[model samples]
Target chain A: MTAPAGQRGRGRPRDPRTDQAILAAALELFTEHGHAGTSIEQIARRAGVGKLTVYRRWGSKDELIAAAVESARGEIPSPGIGDLDGMSYAQISQVIAEALPGSARTLAEPGYRAMLAQVFGSSVTHPGLMAAFWNDHILPRRRTAHLALSRAVDEGVLPPETDIEALIDMTVGAVVYRLLRPEPPDADELLAYLRSVYEQAGMIPRR
Target chain B: MTAPAGQRGRGRPRDPRTDQAILAAALELFTEHGHAGTSIEQIARRAGVGKLTVYRRWGSKDELIAAAVESARGEIPSPGIGDLDGMSYAQISQVIAEALPGSARTLAEPGYRAMLAQVFGSSVTHPGLMAAFWNDHILPRRRTAHLALSRAVDEGVLPPETDIEALIDMTVGAVVYRLLRPEPPDADELLAYLRSVYEQAGMIPRR
Candidate 1:
C-alpha cells in the first residue's frame, strides 16, 4: 500500500517531532480543561499541526487523550528484589523510607493528579478505559511489587501469613488518599508518616 | 426587617414539600449527568417547581448540588468505642466485620460513587468545594473514627504506638481502591481481606 514514488516525494513524510508536540499539547489541555472540554482542533492548533494530521495519527480524541496520559506517566521504576532476600528489619525500614517518598513525589505532581481525577471519573461511564489503564499501567506495577513482597515474606522479612495484596492496597491507597486531599501533606511529612507506618507494622524496631 | 403581615400572607410561605422535591430531583440529575453536565432548569422542571424558586432557595447550582450530596449520604453510624474497652479479639473482629461492610456498601452505591467521582475530579479546579466537603463531611467522620481508634489503642485492643491516622487511611483507602476497581470483590471476600489485615497487625489473634 505504499504511495507512488513521485507522490511520496511531493508530500514530506510524517515527522516524529509532531507526535511529541501533539502529546504535550494534549496533556496540557486535558489537564486544564478535562476530557469533555478539550477538542482535537484545539490540540492541533496548540501543537502547531493540522487537524488532519492529528486525525491520521490518532483516530479519535479518546485515543489521543489516552496516549497523552500514558506519555505523562512516563516510566515507573521497577523496584528490584535482588537485595531483599534475608534483609534485616533495619534494611527493610530503609527500603520503605526510600520507596515511599518517591511515590509521594510522583503522586503529588499537579498534572498527574489532574489526570488521575479524570481517569477515575470517566471510568464509571467508560469501563473500557479503566480496564485498559488497569491492564497497562496498574497491573504491571502491582505484579512487580507483589513479587518483591512475596520474596520478602519467603525470607521471613514479613510475617509468614502476611496478606501481600491487602498490604499493597493499604500502602498505595494511603498515598492516593493524601494526594486527593485539598492540601496534601508535604513530602517530608508524608515520609514521616510512612516511617510511622513501618514502625507500627514492626518492619522497623522501636527506638 | 420583618416583612409586613399582609405581604407575608400574599406571598404564601415557602412549601416544605418543594424542598424535598428539589433535593430528590437534584440527586437524581447530579448522579446521572455529573455536576458540570447538570443544570438548574432541568432540576426545576423535574421537581415541578419554578426556576425562580430553585434559585431563591439554593442561591446557586453548586449549593444545591452540595445539598443533594449531603442528603444522599444520609447518616453514617459512628462506630462506638464504649464496648471496645476491654473487648476481646473475637469481639473486636466482630466490630470490624460489621463496620467495614457498612462503609463499603455506602461507597458502592451508584449514586454515591458518581458523586465521589465528581467531587474528586472537580476538586482540582474547585478547591473551595473540596475544602467545604472536607470540613463538613470528611473531617467529622475522620474525627469520630480517630476517637474510636485512639480508644482501641488505650484499651490494648491495638498496639500502644499504632499510628491511628495512618491506620484509618489504610482502612478507608483499601475500601475505596476496591470500589474503584472494574470488578470489585464481593462482600465476603472484602470482609475476609479486612480480617486478614487486622490479624496481620495483631489487632486480632490468629485462629
Candidate 2:
C-alpha cells in the first residue's frame, strides 16, 4: 500500500472517509441491536475495517457510540442561537412556521424515531449514550430555545411570568410522545399536530 | 401432580399464583433484557414454573409480554373518569393536589423509568408490545383526561376554545420527556416540576 505523505504513525493516515464509515456502522448496529447487543467486532466487520483500526480511533465501544451519537446531533429540527439572533419577532415566527413541515417529515421518519428509542432504551443500561446525546444535542437546543423564549418575553408576545423551561419541556415532550405512540401521525398530520402544540404552548399565535 | 377441580381436558387447572409469577417474571425479564433478548425458558426458570405452563397461558412471546403489560397498567397516575364524575371542581383540584406527591414518587422510581425505557426501546423492533401498552394503558387515561379537561371547560376553569387533546399530549409528554432525561429529577424536584407544568398549562393555579 502506498503511504500518503504527512503520516508519522506506523499505520495508514487517519482518513475522514473511514471515520464516517465506522461511525455510520456503529450507529446502525447500535440502533438495530442496542448497546449491549452490539460489539466492536460487529462494528469493525460491518465497516469492513480491521478491529485494530477501530481500537486505534476508539478505545472502547462506549466511546465509539458516544462519538457516533455526537456526530448525529441535529437530525431533528433544532434552530441554533445563530439562526435566531438579531431576528425580529415576526421573522423568527415565520422561520419556525416554515421549518415545521420539514421538521414534521423528519420526525415521521422511522430511522430517526428508532435512533431515539435506542438512546432512551439504553439509558439505564448504558448511561454514556444518553449522556452524550444530552450534552452534545439537547443542551445546545435548550440554550437556543431559552434565547428564543427570552426574546418572546421581551417582545411582549408571551406573559412576563411565563415558565420558559416548562413551556419548552411541554412542547418538545408533546412532539416526542406523539411520535412514540402506536400509529404515529403521517407527515401532514404531524405538521398539523406540531402547529397545534405550538399554539397550545403559546409559542405561536393561534391560526 | 394432582389436577385441580376445574380441569377440563387439561393436565393441571389454572392457578392465579402461577399466572402472577409467570407474568411478573416476563415483565422483569423484558424490562431488564428487552423483548428480543428474553425468552420463555428464561421466564419459566425465573418464575420457577415449567415452560409448558407459560405455553399453556400465552402461546407466544408477544402474547405473554402483552398480558404482562396489561396487568401492569396504571403503574403511573391515571385518574379515571369515575373518579372525576361526581366531584366538584374544588374537590377535583384537591384530589389531584393530594395525589401529586405519590405520583411524583412513582414517576421518580428507577423501576418505573426502566420499564418505560424498555417499552419505548422495543417499540420499533416489537410493535406488538407498544400496541398492547397503548390499548391497555394509554387509551383509558386519554379518555379520562378528555373528561377532566371538559369538566374544567364546563366549570369555566379553562377557556372555552381550549384544545383538550393537545393539552393532554403536552402534559403527559412533558412528564415523560422530563423522566427520560439523563439526570431525571428526584421526587421533590419532580413534584415541583409537575406543579410548574400544570400551572403553566392552566391545569392548576400558580402556587
lDDT winner among the candidates?
2
The DockQ-based CAPRI class assigned to model 1 is acceptable
Interface RMSD of each: 2.2, 1.2
Q: List the residue pairs that clash in candidate 1.
A: none
By summed lDDT, which 10 consecutive residues of candidate 2 chain A come out lowest?
A: A1-10
lDDT of 2 by residue, B1-58 (tens): 1332222234567899999999999999988888888998999999999877778777
Model 2 regions lying over 4 Å from their true place: A1-12, B1-12, B74-77, B86-88
Model 2 gets an lDDT of: 0.81
Worst 10 residues of 1 chain B by lDDT: B1-10
Q: Which CAPRI level is candidate 2? A: medium
lDDT of 2 by residue, A35-126 (tens): 87899899999999987788777767899999987877666676777888998766676667777887888878777778777887887778
DockQ, all models: 0.45, 0.67
Best TM-score goes to which candidate? Answer: 2
Each candidate's lDDT (Cα)? 0.67, 0.81
